[model samples]
Target: MTTRMNEYKQQIITDFNSRINYDNEFRYRFAKPLIELAQLKPGQRVLDVATGTGIVAIAAAKIVGDAGYVLGVDISTGMLAQAQRKVELEKLQNIELLEADADDLNFDDNSFDVIFCSAAIAYLTDVFTSLCQWYRFLNTGGIVAFSCFAETAHTASILFREKAQIYGITVPNPNATLGNPEKCQYLLQQVGFQNIKVVTQQFGFYLNDAESAWNANANSAYGYQVFQLPPDKLAQLKTEYIAEIHASSTEQGFWHDVNSLFVFARKS
Candidate 1:
């Protein structure tokens, strides 16, 4: 990996590891839907990429029964440790958790019958290349399923970038590449995936206050660039971000759009 990419990966590892405990409930809520869409079956070999805490992996393990196997890989040791605990608690012999980068995985061609990545593909350094790799990892007619956020999702993030631009800072949107159904389908098509499907679901909710929303955005991977600002500048940015939240708030509270896109395709 290039120095920049290595640094980026390290940042991602640090960020996610810190979130291992607090984010599981939220992560599982979204992952449940993706797992249902996967339609896992008995005796199938599965790969769960970036499988934080193995929510999808464990669920797959249960549904696939004793004969099936799952290999869940992630870069965060802390997250994998938690996943291991869960697997052992359930005595699931069919699932294996590994500390590995999703972008650099090595496996023989046609190694898996189904591949899953829930709410994590957008974080890959090269999403298109990663999809191509997954295509190669799957058996012919095998399915690859994953999820991402819509470009217009996360209202706080959208407003944060808009306000940050006025301060001469340009924050990157990680979800930009796989942000929409069309983008998701186009990339899978380019990678030779057939029967591509993109399902949209709204997991959006109202945050009771600006502080709650600010805290979430400030701590997220998407907010890493903004978080790196100097103390003075970051304080000013936070002030402006809170003001934007207030301006956009409704009687119900600030509506944070968690519009998620669950994408599936076959390696035909």
Candidate 2:
């Protein structure tokens, strides 16, 4: 990997490691839909890329039964440790957790019957190339499924980026590459996947107050870009972001749109 790419991966590892103690209920919910889209069968080999906490992997193991196997790979040892503990507690002998980068995985061609990546594809340095790698690892007619957010989703992050631009600082949108259903379809098609399908679902909610929204955005991976700023500038950005949130708030509260897209395709 290039020096910049290596640094990016390190950043991701650090970010996730720090989140080991945080509640993963959101990720668990996000991964469940991908499991349904995968439609895994008994005895089918499965791969879960960036399988943080092994939520999807463990679920897949249950559905696939004892005859099948699951390999959940992640870059964060801290996350993997949590996953391992869960697997052990469940007594799931069919699942294996590995500490590895999703982009650098190596396996024989047609090694898996199903592949899943739940809400973690955006962290990839090269989304298309990674999808193509998954395509090569799947058996003919095998399915690959993943979930991502729409560009318009996460109003807080969107507004933060907009406000940051006024300060001459550019914040990258993680969902820019595969934000919509159409973009997801085109990507799978280009990777030689057939029987493609993209499902859109709104999991939007209202934050109780502007402070809640600000805290959510500031503590997330999206906030990494602004961390390098001077403390005064960062504080100013947070203040401006909170003001924008208040301006946009409704009677219910600040709306945070979790517009999710579940994309599935077959390697044919």
Candidate 3:
């Protein structure tokens, strides 16, 4: 990997570690469908990539029971720390947590019956290499499943971008690639995954008000980029950005539309 790839990995790790205290019930809620889609069964070996807080990993461990095993790998120690706590709290002996990069997943050929990733594929620099690694590690009939933001996911950020452009502040959308169903399919196909299927889900995050919207934004990858903008532009951005967020709110609070895509495939 290049220096840039290393930087991306570090940035992602920092961001997620910083987010350990935020409202993350969604991560736990998301585990059920992700585990189900992977078709986890009793006594099957499972691997969970980016197992933040052990949501998916712990859930898989319960399903796999004592006769099976699950390995959860992540690049962030902060996340794994929380995951370890959860594992101990549950008294689960079937799962192991390790700090490792998804960029180079070193595992034996056909080692796992199921591999799962959730809501973290976009942070990866190259989807192809990760997908190929997944293919190699999965058993011949094993399944690989993951969830990602669709191209149209982050409406608040889109609104912020339009406002920022008015002030001559242009930054990259962190989710610019492999977000839509088409791109998701293309990447998996190129990596020789079979039975490729993508499920699109439309939802929204309920921010209590405009201030809450800004708070959420400030905690995101876009917020980090926005903070680095020139002072004058950043000031202008804050004004219009807040106004846009306020305008989108209602009695039910501000609703940020979340469009997500769930990608699943099998190693043939």
Best by TM-score: 1
Worst 10 residues of 1 by lDDT: 19-28
Clashing residue pairs in candidate 2 (N, C-alpha, C atoms within 3 angstroms): none
Ranking by TM-score: 1, 2, 3
Q: Record all residue pairs in model 3 with backbone atoms less than 3 Å apart, i.e. clashing.
A: none
lDDT of 1 by residue, 17-130 (tens): 887454546777999888888899999999999998888999999999899999999999989988999999999999999989898998999999999998888888889889
Better candidate by lDDT, 1 or 3: 1
Tens digits of per-residue lDDT, candidate 2, 1-268, equal 6875766777787778878565457766777788988888899999999998889999999999999999999999989999999999999999999989887899999999999998899988789999989999999999999999998898888898887777777778999999998899889899999999999988888876777666655655565667678899988988988888887888888888999999999999
lDDT at 114, model 2:
95
Count backbone clashes in candidate 3: 0
Candidate 1 RMSD computed on C-alpha atoms after optimal superposition onto the true structure: 1.6
TM-score of each: 0.94, 0.93, 0.90
Candidate 1: give the clashing pairs.
Answer: none
Which window of 10 residues has the lowest lDDT sum in candidate 2? 215-224
Residue-level lDDT tens digits of model 3 in 63-130: 99999999999888888998898899999999999998877689999999999888887766677888
Which residue segments of model 3 deviate by more than 4 Å? 1-7, 22-24, 167-169
